[model samples]
Target: MVVTNIAFIPARGGSKRLPRKNILPFLGKPIIGHTVLAALQTQLFDRVVVSTEDTEIAAVVSQWDVEVDQRSHALAGDSVSVVEVCLDFLDRTYKNRLPDTMVVLYATAPLRRAEDIQSVMNLLDEDCHFAMAVSVCHWPVHQVLKNHGDHVVPVFPELIHSKRSQWDRYYLDNGSTYAVHVDAFQREKTFYGHRLKIHEMPRARSIDIDTVEDFEWARYQAERMLL
Candidate 1:
């Protein structure tokens, strides 16, 4: 059925730090499976599709009741930007008629919850064309160290001794949820288009699994939740 809101998941099969990380098992299921389940549970999407170039990954995602876009090799390389993958799907699936909104969920961040996903989407409005999940910075950088040949100097000496209240607060993309107006996304060829908004997420559920150590840490986090 045609719908105005779609959830697009980009799960490429190659990974240098962790091979097949997109489908790596986590808490008795593929890591991507957790994201798929969360997206479905939110009930915010009219359609949820996983776009991947690997048959193996596609085979695994097929277990769920979601559409799988067999992306081309041109969009699967490590250097290729994720925007290309998303644009390819949008151009092909919707053609000239585009959905009102599209949500991009990464497969690595499995701990993000359905409520958080909804919160991210809820942030989209006329004033904000891009909305995403972010986690408050634990150690917000007040000054940077720049090394000249033999010695290092503070980049921003003025901020070196500033109090926490005086320092600017910082937030980082948690690599979990992102929602954007389809029109703005195509116009800018990126998700970071137009007025951006954020839905703050807890550090506990903001884990983006990229390496073996990250996987282990995420497992510890998820296991603790079950208890």
Candidate 2:
């Protein structure tokens, strides 16, 4: 049937805590232009790349005409892992043709929609190979704590002081959507790999913008849920 969805957006630049954060400015677009316009309004991507080593985020994601894989300053570091810039854009643009779905969108999680990435590609059926977009970990994930220099501890140390309403209804990975199955991502290249499925957004669209108070609380929830 020749289906091939490929919306990989990993805008890397020198962001040491939000400098040039994927072309900043949010509510009037620029934050990877609303994640490349929610992967082109989820007309279920045939291709909507953006792997940037930054030529002004590859000229603002080539003005949404998409394709801009110019990465490799040794995969543009800061310990490069958007799964190694998504296997370096599937080993440089689908080498020898391999794309039967691989969406990873995360331009700092711009208020995920476009039916929250087509409902995580409608759970990518056929015994699943991965799909994502979780939320509802509204703090107190089993009293998580760390830093052990005369201070905190319980990072799930037996869920210390456990408030188990079944571990407080947890769910996370709201790193704004993902989907897999490029043959189980070339055999488990990992996005929590095989057989996974989920799609439960709504921590007001799961904000993932790093600091500056999470870009002013995702611009106050994108001005009350992006118009």
Alpha-carbon lDDT, every model: 0.90, 0.81
Model 1 quality (TM-score):
0.94
Q: Which candidate tops TM-score?
A: 1
Cα lDDT tens digits, model 2, 1-227, are 35388888888888898798778888787877888887898788877888877788888777667888788788787887888778866776655768888889888887887898888888988889899999877788767788999899888887777655656577888887789888777778888876788899888778888778988888887788655
**Top lDDT prediction, candidate number:** 1
Runs in model 2 lying further than 4 Å from the true structure: 1-5, 8-22, 25-58, 63-99, 109-126, 133-169, 180-207, 210-212, 216-227
RMSD of 2: 16.5
lDDT of 1 by residue, 137-162 (tens): 88848766899889998888888988
Task: Single out the weakest 10-residue window by summed lDDT for candidate 2.
Answer: 161-170
Q: Residue 49: error of model 2 in Å?
A: 2.6
RMSD of 1: 1.7
